[model samples]
Target: MALFVETGLKPLSANESYLGKKTKSKAYRMYENHLLRVLPDLPLEPKGKMKLTAEVYYSNKLSDLDNALKPFIDCLQKRYLFNDNRIYKLEVEKFIVEKGAETILFRLDPYSQEGDKDYVPHPTDDREHRCPECGHSF
Candidate 1:
């Protein structure tokens, strides 16, 4: 069985060309060809700006190994960053695994307010718990 590790990170500043965009989706060719070759079939959003900032999706299977993504991410910081190696923004956007590999869902802020959207029940989740209006849940 395989589990995925998807972290949605926002770009530090105006680093655009580094992250490609076909239309509204960020192109994963760089991600696929380089970082996550083990799972070549990682999913991505359509060509557009990601919800809050730029994001990349990666997948892993092993549970213990699932959390080993930190050092892998450090490679990005060291290799990229044209200036004086300042890590811009690297945070866990969300963490989930697809049992059926069908629909890929994660909470996003289309409007980017502190209290107006989410489906996850965990209290520690950054965003809101309810739909913020409709009050939906997973």
Candidate 2:
């Protein structure tokens, strides 16, 4: 699925980058609210690993990809789009949009572990138990 938001809001600064900045500016607060409002309702517990991709179309070429994506991706965590740790892969791309039109497109998909030999389920899985003592498998 995809969610779209208007472009041009700046991202939050990385931790402690600017020393002694005691307060969040109004613009930052507004940006946070806007992201929350635009984010779609995501599953509280994803079925499996997830892949998130964002396509940022900006009128200005100077916008940094990581800076543009941080606020939105972080909001996904707050809104339960899936934990950042569960993400198997992440993709972000930027494109120059027409002078007057710029927008951000967010897409997400669940990835199943079926057929994957390296898959190791979480401890909470209750599907079945194997008999280690006997030569039996469940």
Candidate 3:
């Protein structure tokens, strides 16, 4: 099932820094509070590898795509009692919309690589590959 949240809140970057202290920003705190009131109860506990697809509607086009993932994923991890490490595949897209129309749509699904013929290797996978032309391993 897909979840939709319309909080009129701007996306907060996880990289926000303050005085060399490690902490969540005020925007993130407000976003979390808003999520607590709007998020629905799940019927089952999510386990194993998972896939997350997020569609973020922002008021402007200047926001970086990568900056939006951390805050939202952190909240989902807290709410669902699951580790973000379990997410094997993540897909995020952002759209520019009018102010006050900012929203986020999320879909979480169980995923497994077993018996899949067309699976692409993740960049962080430990396996080494040999260059076909140079005969070098990277």
Candidate 4:
């Protein structure tokens, strides 16, 4: 099943939160509030494997991608969209729109794995090729 949500509220950037002050948590709280007001109640089922797609119509082109993504994921977790750990895949894009409402549109899709062969090795592949010239293990 796929779920979609869209909001016109502008998101706080991680850069804005971390630039020079201790306002990260406070900004996140405000962002969360705005999202809660616009978002619908999430479904009760906890998704096991899902891909998240986010399109950010940014009010400012200076906003960092990762910064914009943080509070959104936090808000989703707060509203019980799904466990953060359950998100196996993520896709995010940012667009600059002059004289347009800033917004975030997202979709959650249940991902279907092809097979074990498609799974990437998680550092356990044992291909020791780090620092080959120096033969350093660090």
Candidate 5:
């Protein structure tokens, strides 16, 4: 299924501390509530490994891509009655846009390993590695 959200994505940050207990920031809480209100109901069946692809548009380039997934996935899990552990593949892309134009587009589908391949090595992968004990390249 596909879903689109018009509001800006909020990262799940460690910003709140109440008596040493962590709490979500007010902004994050508001964002979660907004998502719950706007997100459509999801099917309860078809439980299995799933794949999630998300295209995130941010107002600026200051946000880290990894931080945006948890909050959005959490909302999906809570509202859809599905477990996050069922997700076997996740792909996310980020784009920068003008303020107030931030949005997110995502899709969920059953995962298949048919086309999976081994990881490709980076260009620098063959470079000499440093020995942790001596801090010397070997």
Candidate 6:
């Protein structure tokens, strides 16, 4: 049982107890419930349901979570709540297909040009190299 019930959740049952004692708790709960219903459609919610849940789970109130997502939504260009997960997968697949067989970037030394003594050997495959000769990049 949560601390709410462990502490014995009960109706005050009298006008005086409810009006005086339980008012704040009841108001807070109502506000939290209202926020939960509103947060998902807000501008700050993340780009997918799974991402939204993962990103916003930190807040005890949905309003807080929605507020927290503001910077992320701005950084991510407000690409919230994709209707299809497979579209996301397809984006990944497109990048992989376009960059096929490129030399992995870490294998190349950025400062080194062709004849530098510190130059690293980058392994290349059959793909046409649209990247700089230093390494296969996007």
TM-score: which candidate is best? Answer: 3
lDDT of 4 by residue, 73-127 (tens): 8788777656766777778899988757888899877665555344554334365
| Candidate 1, superposed: residue stretches over 4 Å from native | 1-33, 36-69, 78-85, 99-138
> How close is every model to the real structure, measured as TM-score?
0.23, 0.57, 0.68, 0.64, 0.67, 0.16
Which pairs of residues have clashing backbones in candidate 1? Answer: 3-60, 3-61, 23-47, 24-46, 24-47, 24-48, 25-46, 25-47, 25-48
Against the hidden true structure, what lDDT does model 2 obtain? 0.69
Tens digit of per-residue lDDT, candidate 1, span 51-80: 323222435443443243433443333343
Clashing pairs in 6: 47-80, 47-81
TM-score, prediction 1: 0.23
- Residue 84 CA error for candidate 5 (Å)? 0.5
Candidate 4, which ten residues in sequence have the lowest lDDT sum? 1-10
Tens digits of per-residue lDDT, candidate 6, 1-138, equal 222212123445335544454433575556445544544443432332222222232312323433433333332332333332212111000112222342111110112135445434554458553434445342
Question: Given candidate 1, what's the lDDT at residue 132?
Answer: 42
What count of clashes does model 1 give?
A: 9
What are the lDDT scores of the predictions, listed in order? Answer: 0.35, 0.69, 0.77, 0.70, 0.77, 0.32
TM-score, cand. 3: 0.68
**Order of quality (TM-score):** 3, 5, 4, 2, 1, 6
Q: Which parts of model 5 are misplaced by more than 4 Å?
A: 1-20, 115-138
Task: List clashing residue pairs in candidate 2.
Answer: none
Clashes of 5: 0
lDDT of 5 by residue, 64-129 (tens): 887789889998887777898898788899999999998889888877666556323333447666
Q: What is the lDDT of candidate 4?
A: 0.70
Provide the lowest-lDDT 10-residue window in model 3: 1-10
**TM-score for model 2?**
0.57
Compared with the true structure, the alpha-carbon lDDT of candidate 1 equals 0.35
